[model samples]
Target: MEKQTSANKPHIMTIPYPYQGHMNPMLQFSKRLASKGVQITILATNDVKTSKLAHTSSINIEYISYEIEQGDEIPKSVAAGLGYVNHKVLKRVPGIIEKHKASGSPIKVIVYDSLIHGALELAHKLGLRGASLFTQTCAVCSVYYHVQRGSLALPLEGHTVSLPSIPVLEIEDLPSLVQAHDRLYPGLLEVIKKQFVDLEKAEWIFFNVFDKLEEEIAKWLSSQWPIKTIGPSIPSMFLDKRLPDDRDYGLNLFKPDAEACIKWLSAKATGSVVYVSFGSVANLAQNHMDELAWGLLNSNINFLWVVRETEQNKLPGNFKAEASEKGLVVSWCPQLEVLAHKAVGSFMTHCGWNSTLEALSLGMPMLVMPQWADQTTNAKYVVDVWQTGVWVKARDKEIFTREDITNRIKDVMDGAKGEELRVNAIKWKEQAVEAMSEGGSSDKNIDEFISKVISTTT
Candidate 1:
């Protein structure tokens, strides 16, 4: 084991593209890096500033807020796409960087989000060290690379393309998210390719995935470019193993909702209740929510759902009704504590990286309902590789159809395969913990990664 040291005590600026998933991982990465002597500054847009999140700790690292000057000339959609609000914000960063250098907080390196391609050009122009923090997994990165090289094209509109190299996935039963049609966003892919052209500008590339989880593909990635596998980056610094492990608190964020729903699980027996949550950001249409409402009603299983503001639709006003006495519905609750609870036998989730990791970490079986973005990719791993979940495709878009809604949830909760998935989910959970422990793959990569990126700051 390596002792903490001050070798990496050079100033590092982390600029994440504006988004929850991207921002969260970079913050956690910098937090851990700062703990080991790295001086990190998280750069956020002035409009979508990270001012409140700046660590006010006694650590030597500093966080600076710089605004991309806002202007009225650009349309709302165009500004988001261009990564600028007003021309001022784009024009000001270089000046800000120069000022920082003048102030003696000389940036030894700049860590930019891969999605922000323009930042690469700006970094080179300013003469600073730089790296690209890819918030997606190595597999997704490989798909982007292979697609760029012409080895693959997104499957034709109606067909599926087979990726034989991906382990645990068969050609005949290809995971829905990995399938050809309805894959990759047409507009976003174009933006990504242009940004990737700036790959040569980066000093290093870091991915949000682990060695044990994607070893083969990660190795393949390293062959083409300087790559680091350091992921499953949940703000896991929060977990306390010293506490009693009764389990089933469910999945959640920095705050724990342990008391909020653990009581609901108390009355239910193990392997009897199903939990459904699609994460904080994703929302299905009202009809879909209604369909899901009735689906839960028909499943003959006791279920708990956490519906957010966006998922609002007129379901039976007291949808949880007599079941309200039996079922629980809340706009939001602590997720991890619920997942860890004793009564949560299964989870129907949105397949986000954090959720997937929590499910795998807790050894809880899942029913994957990927909404969009990396969720599709996450679902593939859950249902295909981990053998811990079932993928529920949104085949019938009319989410109002009671029959489709009820049957999908039913398939996830009570199929003959659910029990097998439960056993495997637990085994993977242990493996996940081991991967983060001493000499674990995640621990090794975190050490190795700092050396490759922030360590050279001086």
Candidate 2:
């Protein structure tokens, strides 16, 4: 066998969009590639603080500086961030590559977030391979692809949508961006549309999903592109346990109230607590917050809800005191740990892809309350297709009410339907493990990716 040296190992640089959700899966994928003996470098804007995660892994994270005066305005900041990445950062990648090459570890490939439009072109310009890492599911990506290709016209004509390999979707079930293009931030809408620009030119396209989860859509999309499903992208401890001490993702934007949550949950009986969160980004309107708070109270079930400090003021007056006996409210909790705990009966979530995958991986059913973006689509699959959970249905002419939330929580906890949801959830959890196990679908795809990089680079 040839001796492996720093110079001979294939180096790959990962550039994720500067968001917690985007950066996490890319970092997990880096860990997977590193386990296979490939050299991994994760590039981020200087504003992102990933040192805690970086110190825990063998992978290297390099931060590049680009000045942007961000403020309370989100859309403005997004526009500025995109500008910094496309123009300022793209211009500097070559120097970074040369610096790495001089250090005896040259970047042979650039694996970038799919939403970044210029990464593939820049990779080809520098004579390196490019792989687009899509953090969304095949179903959501297919919808976006059709929209970009002009097959699904904007200002959609009807109340229903039918697409290849996707279930017939109601107009409201579509992604919020697609449903109301004019209402959302224009900058983000444009960035999402650019996900398919020159997409076919990439050397590889990877989705953070398992094949069986979206079998028909994966089959159709794979035929057109060099697509691979190499995910659930969760830590090893929760899935296949192939990697050592991989219990957490190691990067959390918010510190978790771990001890309090675990101790409280430990006191409860198995399958007795409701876990509620809206993820990191989604900020519910005051009305929605009030509804959710009272709804959990009305469910008459033991619950733990993560309400960010910013959103706590929106809660009804004396809410925490009233529900103190039955509920625990915290800013954040270690999500995977909470999900894996026996006390957690079901998740009341916004159905973000990462959260959905985490719930599925842990055999926890969901009461999906989709807020925006691809969440609506994920909620649909969770309820209609996967049979893993029930949706939080709203009353007529109302978005969602306290009564609706109370009913959904009951359906997932004490109702007969909860049994069916648990059965399906356990089955999906086992399938998730199989996908990451040795010789499994995602594992095989990852091995193939590593081999191709080595063969081409060597």
Off by over 4 Å in 1: 1-8, 45-70, 76-82, 85-92, 154-158, 167-186, 237-259, 262-272, 393-416, 452-458
Best by TM-score: 2
lDDT per residue as tens, model 2, 1-458: 12236656789999887677887899889888887778888887664464467575578878776564365223255655675566655876888899998987789999999877798999999899999999999999999888888998988888899999889999888898898864666666667878888888999999999988899999999887989999999999999997876888887878899999999999999999999998999999988889899999998999999999998889899999999999999999999999999999999999999999999888999998888999999999999999898878751345788998899899889989999999999999999999999999999998888878888888
**Candidate 2 residue pairs that clash:** none
Question: Each model's C-alpha lDDT?
Answer: 0.64, 0.87
Q: Assess every candidate by TM-score.
A: 0.80, 0.95
Poorest stretch of ten by lDDT in candidate 2:
68-77
TM-score of 1: 0.80
